[model samples]
Target: MKRKDYALEAKRFVDAAGGKENIESYLHCVTRLRLNVIDKTKVNEAEIKDSPLAKGINWTQNQLQIILGTGVVEAVYAEVQKIMEVSNASMDEKLDNSKLEDFKLQVKANKETLRNKSWFFGEIQKGMRVLGDIFVPIIPAIVAAGLAMGVSALLKQILNPSGEQLNSLLWIIVDIVTKTAFDSLAVLVCWSTVKRFGGNPVLGIIIGLMLVNPLLPNKGSIAAYNAQLDFYNNQLIEGLSKNEIYKAWVEAGLKWIGQAPTFDANGNVITNAVMGDPITAIKVWIIPITGYQGSVLPALIIGVAVAYLEKWIKIWMPKAVNIIFTPFLTITIAFLVALFIFGPILLMVEQGILIATKAILGIKYGFGTAIIAGVLQGIVITGCHQVLQGLEMQLVIDGSLPGANGAAATGSIFNAIWTASIISQGGAAMAIAVKAKDKSDKELGFSAAISTLFGITEPAIFGTNLPKIKPFIYASIGGFFGGLFAGILNVTCPGMGVTVIPGLLLYTGNWTKLLGIIGVNIISFGVAFLLTLFLFKDGIQSKKTKLGLKFEQLKNKIKLDKFKIKRKSAE
Candidate 1:
């Protein structure tokens, strides 16, 4: 029906149902009108159903539902709100959106206000979007780094038997490639975050590449290293601070000044009438003044100058602000936030988590590594996996954690859980495909398989397993056994991710140990699938619900007329 007719249709229904005063709280979910009644006697549900408004009548677990599909429910809800003089105490608190259009406009304006604040926040938002976009691709890159390094002896032989001719070039190339990939992971993560937020991906990539470029001399060390060698001192000091060259210049000047005593008044060498303290004053003081100018002092002066300039820019930028100026402001704010806020917060969080984990494991005698691993394994995976990534990157930068342990572990977990879920769900699907009688059960069986593969287990869990009792029992039993086995193996994870199986790659150097972990997961999945199949075969077959004799009498009348017509036509 057209929406124009809904108001009139709703008014008629409300009037028939005791002028809406009889209705108490009203809510809607999916297919039904959830209405709490003031007086059940006043509500003629049969008449309400017969009034050409509602689809059907049902009372389940205290909910008096008026079923209506699609547009009809919304139309009815709107009209009811307008004419129905609802009692405040009896009304549902959530049926308050009478002026939805106005509220929507207000919400939009508020969002715009926030967006207009500064360019910096916009950049942050952009970075977040970029990060979200590239989150998946980075996984493969991380895995490649690990694979290039030797997996344990079982997976890959690091020590080759043939000593005939070692390929030094290939070895060197691989080493360089892996090292470079591992070193710049952070820059990639940050750049991706920015790109996802709508900034240029190429720009972000450029920035990332620059941040970790090892070829670029570190600002602090170049000066010190160049000062020792004469050839390097001349060439490299040109690039270093003035202070670096000032000391060298100061010493040469002092040496010349010291010998000035022998020079005559007209710049000729006086020989006998030498100055009293030309060398002492030059050696002790004048050179040091020039030395300070050449070194850190100039850099410090420049930094102060730039900082004041930035402060002044901030003060003036807001007055001349426009849409174009917005990007510049946002970029500035984002840079500050990245350098100050995000960077420090990430570092501290990473350190805290690492410290806590180490402390847990470092306990003497009383603590079991496997038990600690099991307890923390899931907890850390939820949100704290980022912590491990941060720490691992920090370690790599510091020359501590080799390669990318954090990323590798994450991959292993993703592969492991993914494989186990697929196998288990596949088994359930096969069993249901063969044994289930009811159409709903058979359909649910297929859906369960699909959901499991995608990592959303709610429907499979709550709808099928928990309700059936047998599947739930088996799954819990399986989870417990798996947890126990995982605990016993002392499987240590330096990283975390989605899949359970591939996460075993975190222990790549210990291929035997990884296989042991994989074996345990398989056993868990196998036990759950086998037990569930054995217990639920009968349950699947006997799923029909017998309505009471009173309700059963109405079945023929409720059945669609098409079936009746077809039967009569056939006869």
Candidate 2:
């Protein structure tokens, strides 16, 4: 009956983890507090998991991740930091000089790679966490950009009934705000990667900027050209070939005279677009070699290369030239290597991932999508789901691609499944709320469930569903059905990140797809809710455990509350 105190909970977590002396460093993410401890033996796993505040807990990559939902994690993290600092000062005073350096060494060791072994699961975990470190911070930018694009798209449909494009200053400003994030996203990725790898961010950004330089043709232009070619090729008439049609149009409009090339998945110029034009390096090479704009992997590899290269250069590059020569040498060597080496290799890897993921979604009968959605949340349990952000962003950015039977493929299919998988958590949590007898527990369940309607699910998953296990299974089942329907119906969104109710704002201008997505979401939620309520196996027995009454059943609840209050006072 006492109010919960996060600070007190934080102190307990630290004490259970062998105090501040054992912890090397600590930080918090959206749903968990990650502690990098010096000695894993010192951590008390059983005691930590026993705390009421902890929703779930796991150890990976030599770091202890305590899932404490969302808001509580932040508060607890602050308390943990304060406790560590205070304890650290006293511990330093007590330690002798001989042991100090060794302690510092251990701390430093924890800060670097702390994976268990080279060939063990630790390396994969380390890579996944590094990926998380790179992409997690930039999620806001992706979401904001997606929302702006959605809003702009909705306004365009309403304000321009004739379907004429708008180019007013205000619209241009909106374009700038939204486009900058995608267009310049490479810089953000490079900057983040460099910082994570202990290199100068300014230099990282310079290398990033070089990738999207104006000298190269824009990637968007190439896509448009490919789409146009596809269109003309299909509409062949008057004995004109695809190249002939494109050339005629070019000649008609002298305003444009440039190479038209179709790039393969690996960024190679595989097709010549214009008629009678030789596939010369001067013509198709520039496009492949041009700016990466909106790319992820290329910039990422280049960023890491530059970071390590810069760090390596600093080892012998004398202090006098630290300012000028170090940057120049690092940039020069890294740029050449990226352009000549990592650029081609990484492009293939990036394209392969995109194509492979889409290929899975493109599987017959929606089995691939169903499997992905079923396992997505389980992946979130390990915090490695951040790796999917890039694929989702690129899919959304690609808009609708040409598909069979005059129906275009949806741009955000992955996002649609993601939303469905996540929304099911809300349903499961609400099911628990419907079963809770204690007012506080009921409130916590309801609040956590509601939070998921806006795209946050950790609270619902950790706080309400994970405790019983059945609710989690029910929610995932809901997601599986939702995903199967989503893929079959070709349900999709205009963006990524946002989901559920607010996600509706993105479904504008397409009633069929919108309705389809809404239906799947409902199916996902309803199935989970109904399953958790009716077929919980021991549903009746569990209800007697302490859940509150349903709204329609509140009369009995009132009498029950009064009787419990009286009994508590007497005790």
Candidate 3:
């Protein structure tokens, strides 16, 4: 067999896709190289599909996706990016007036396509891709932290049972590893968000640091701080409430700004007349803005606003003064908006989602669990699964969701569903591998299925199950049952990030839950495999054709090698 040259293949891919100039932007998710091209008509879809390196091709959400297996996709993407940079540099050196006009025209066409009714959904899909790009870079650190926390929990159960204090260096190490990433999650999120939104990442870091400033009261201390503040001149105010404290702060602000508050008939300050309804509401919910340590949405919202504000400032200010003014105005505006408006609103939204999730997953007989598991893969296909990152992180930090019998479990129920869905995809891929008659098809299927065991299903989903519709359907059905079983057992995950094989560390202290998770995987795999084998016929026939071709190629290769040896001996 000939060794594959991924770099060469990547270059060919670039040319077939109408060169680097045609590419607007490109990104990869697990298994596929997703490219947004300036002109879809210019892309040679047939050439891309015919490439020996490409496992499959999919056109979805207004992006061209070329399926390359998990690890291979990353390598191909790097090579492609390198090629584009070299190509672009060369074009810049030889640039002329007509070429410059052409470049501008291409940019204009790209912008026009964004507003076209045909491409509206494509633009929305790009939003999801942007979200993925922001968080994907930070995932490794988060996953490592979660794993460390899980290990610490396990050590506590084994080494310090019954709450016996065993203060040791080992415990300190565990604590450091567990807290470092999670405690400063906002900082990481801010850096990534700002970079994605085309702003200075350092400004994003400054904003993130402010959100989680050491001087700010921690979330756990907010209540005590509020109560302490309720005292005026060291005299405790009787019947003091959070609302009253907030009102006092707002009134103090009014006075500082040289405005007098108007009172109503009951001697109460009319909040609407003083600062309007929206600002009043913001003030009331201000207590929740202490820190965004475990939050995602708030930092993202702030980063977006900062990016736009910085751009606007640069446009209006003189070049000589813009440097100083841009950073100053950008941070000032972003920080104030985050502190007073977006932060509180997003906090409430986060709380609401948490509350709603608990209610749904806490439903009788694990109905919610089944539904979430069943639809989760579909969500991933549509690129909406990134939304779960924040939810899963919050759930893991919260430790456990409400369950029956007042029993608090030690892991995330949401993660359990994710685990089931991921494993089911692997199972579906594996079944296709088993039923495949062609050597190439079997290899692709087996590789994709194996990749899923490590909690990466893009290879399995895009390379195998997606192409065979019935397998995907069967896998989803398997996921639902697996999730149902997990919910019934009240399975909990100790952390987020890694799922499936590596996720076992999260259940170190709870063997029963671990076994239940294993059972879920087995059941999901079994159901998906059986359903795909019995129901899908196209997969079987496709394999047979490919296998026969492979055999013929192998025979021809053997004959050629023999002929070469004979000729060499005669010479």
* Estimated TM-score for each candidate: 0.32, 0.51, 0.51
lDDT of 2 by residue, 1-571 (tens): 1224777888889988767777766666666787766655457888988888888676554567788876778788887877776855777787786466665554444334223223343454465556655664565565466456556655654565333336699999998986787678778788878866778889988988887776665644444344344435453744555555544444322111244557789976577665332221113354234456767666777789888999888899889878899899989998777666655554455455446556677677877788678767875653234435545644553354344465755667876788778889889878888886445446666876776676666557655675456788999999988889988887876555456765665677689988987987898899888988776633223432222123114324333223221123544
Task: For residue 392, give model 2's deviation from the true position in Å.
Answer: 15
What lDDT is obtained when candidate 2 is compared to the true structure? 0.65
Which pairs in model 3 have colliding backbones?
411-493, 412-493, 438-543, 438-547
lDDT of 1 by residue, 487-553 (tens): 4454333332223333444446467657755765575566666766676544312321211222233
Among all windows of ten consecutive residues in candidate 3, which has the lowest summed lDDT?
A: 273-282
Q: RMSD for each model, in Å, please?
A: 22.8, 14.8, 15.8
What overall lDDT goes with each candidate model? 0.41, 0.65, 0.65
User: Model 3 reaches what TM-score against the true structure?
Assistant: 0.51
